[model samples]
Target: MSGLSTTWFGVIRSTIDGNVALSDINLGDPDGNEIVHDTIGKNLICTNMFPAPQIGDADDGIPDPSYPFSTVGRNVIGQCGFVLAP
Candidate 1:
């Protein structure tokens, strides 16, 4: 696993198994407003995703355990972003 970052209340843990390679990934909210967590994985390949969100707007570089919107699994990410949603 490589290239992982968070904005505000962001906490992440990566566990590598078998053979895997990850790059430029920011699992949960771009600003890390949510608790983005990752578990065991095997034979995986990822890149160019999970960028930090703009300053302010709830994610003020603070860790808020009460913030919702956690969990970044069971999804197909190929460039589209959650921040770009309506």
Candidate 2:
């Protein structure tokens, strides 16, 4: 028989709003100084999604052990989700 295989998935959601500005000015005769300014105004929101695992009873011939199946499910839910931003 082949060895057991496993996979994991996950996702994250966030939204960001901000502003950026750049400016340069020169004043003098022939030689002048350059000035630059950057400013940002933002609002951000972040969320994490996780789900519970499903398991069957041992008498039902389902794998009740918490090594591979359960672990995989937990990992998947813990790491899988979606993000919404505008």
Candidate 3:
């Protein structure tokens, strides 16, 4: 399927799990580049998925001053206003 539009303005299920799936998401197709997502028209597309975990706690006397995140270097937001040039 070289020219098949299996991902044309539609949501695709990229992954799944048994009994532990975290709500299957619909992340449309990739634009010119088959890696970046296209959310230009999808009004429900959110920019930030989760806020960077803070290191301080309100009850703690001293702040931890350190943020330990497992997925800090990954881009989660879908690309908006992206157009495939013809």
RMSD each, Å: 12.1, 25.6, 16.8
Candidate 3 clashing pairs, residues 3+ apart or interchain: none
Please identify model 2 stretches exceeding 4 Å from their true place.
1-53, 59-69, 78-86
**Clash number for each model:** 1, 5, 0
Go through the candidates in order and give each one's C-alpha lDDT: 0.39, 0.19, 0.23
Residue 49, candidate 3: Cα error in Å is: 11
**Residue runs of model 1 more than 4 Å from their true location after superposition:** 1-56, 79-86
lDDT of 1 by residue, 1-86 (tens): 46665544432444434433445656555444322333323333344546532222443456455542223333423432232112
Error of 3 at 77 (Å): 3.9
Regarding TM-score, does 1 or 2 come out ahead? 1
Tens digit of lDDT per residue, candidate 3, span 1-86? 11222323222212212111111223233231121212223132223212211111321334222421112122333332121211
lDDT of 1 at 6: 52
The global Cα lDDT (0 to 1) of model 1 is 0.39
Best candidate, TM-score: 1
What TM-score does prediction 1 earn?
Answer: 0.23
